[model samples]
Target: MGGQPPAEPASEEYTVDQLAAKVGMTVRNVRAYAGRGLIPPPRLVGRTGYYGPDHVARLTLVRELLGKGYTLSAVERMMSELPDGALALGVFETLVSPWTPAEPEVITEQQLADRAGIPHDPATIAKLIELGIAERVDDGRLRIPNPDLLRTGLEVIKLGVPLDAIFEMLPKLFEQADQVAKIYVELFRNTVWRQFADAGLPAEGWPEIQRTLENIIPLAGQALVAAFRESMGREIETAAYEELGLPPDEFSSTG
Candidate 1:
């Protein structure tokens, strides 16, 4: 099946042992990732650490990447480049947090063909797998880890954006996003999370830490939206002015 994969079931809180089993990882490996900061520290509830949906998603993604032949050290380095909250949940999820639906759509291979305007394109499907957008499951159905990206790419293609251009641009976009994320994460880490960590991670401080972590997602999103809008507006204004043959000084400062 090459269609939209079914949404994963709602995530549940899991103990360390349960989480390890759920993700098909040995307990030792799970703990190893945690220690390496490849995953977030679990929610501390007394002596037991409880994991959440974010943890499950992160672990699954890590396993998938590893299965695709990424070395553990390479995966760890790539993951380490993500912003703090990003690693804890997922880089994709963090970037698309505002718009992501609670559940992903499920469609048949025929439906996917309809969307692509091709009944069966093995090369195209293979490219999708290479891009990490979709994967073929054990049952033979395709699973799209990031459906938003797939839909967006399809829309852009329909709009005449060449596939090659899209492919060429994705890596550049990811690099820029990662760079920007580091700036914000450093700001928060230095001023907030790092302090909490250095203080022995006292139980009483956990709520504040969690609250700050939760707030960072939306706050960073708002900043990104603002910056993009401002940049776009400037570009549009310049294009419009050039169209009218206006000099720079002919325009009054809008700001």
Candidate 2:
């Protein structure tokens, strides 16, 4: 009996044009990066070249670094230093991505109004955009980047809260949220990140850094929610006591 040959492993390969589209870059930029040796040379068969996953990862990293204000030379220098640039990119993405990812939903103006229980008017749509609740797409339809947030806002409105009052509160709420975020970011920067930097950001440390980041995200969210609940309860109880014209301790005796 003869032994059977093994099957070839499947791999993704892309032409230059396909690669450009896949990474949301132009063909010229892809060629330019290749010319600058920013990415590895593609596999060539006769006159044509085909790219694989590493090309895609490198191009994506280049674009991300440039978007984050890195100069071309700086990007080149950083890419040269990293032993596994792709792994670093994965860590970078995890660090910067939203803690709770949400799928964006596109809807017509009428649908938005119906879902939100608000008027289907230009002013209302503008307000929604202003509040970052919705964004106007190229086709003039609205996209809700965070549908969960919109749903939560709608729930608040259903509790007899005026839409205008909610809108008025959002800016302050966002400001406080930003402050909370900064506090956590600064803590990480001063501690974990500082240590990583001091250790020269070794290639072996990326996995641990990513794990720390993953752990911190949920922990930070839980802490924020717990703190807010405690603060909200205290304020509500104080307000209730004042409304009833009683001292804070008098409630226990009355009950």
The TM-score of predicted model 1 comes to 0.54
List candidate 1 stretches off by more than 4 Å.
1-110, 118-120, 239-255
True-vs-predicted CA distance for residue 143, candidate 1, Å: 1.8
Once superposed on the true structure, which residue ranges of model 2 sit more than 4 Å away at CA? Answer: 1-27, 40-53, 63-83, 98-101, 253-255
Q: For each candidate, what is the lDDT?
A: 0.74, 0.84
Residue 215, candidate 1: C-alpha displacement in angstroms:
1.9
lDDT of 2 at 88: 67
**lDDT of each residue in 1-255, candidate 1, tens digit only:** 557664333357788999999999999999999998878888775577888877777787778678768999988876665434324344344334554544555555666768866566667677767777778777666777767777988898788777778877877877898898889878887988688768866656655666666678788879998999999889988887898889868986566
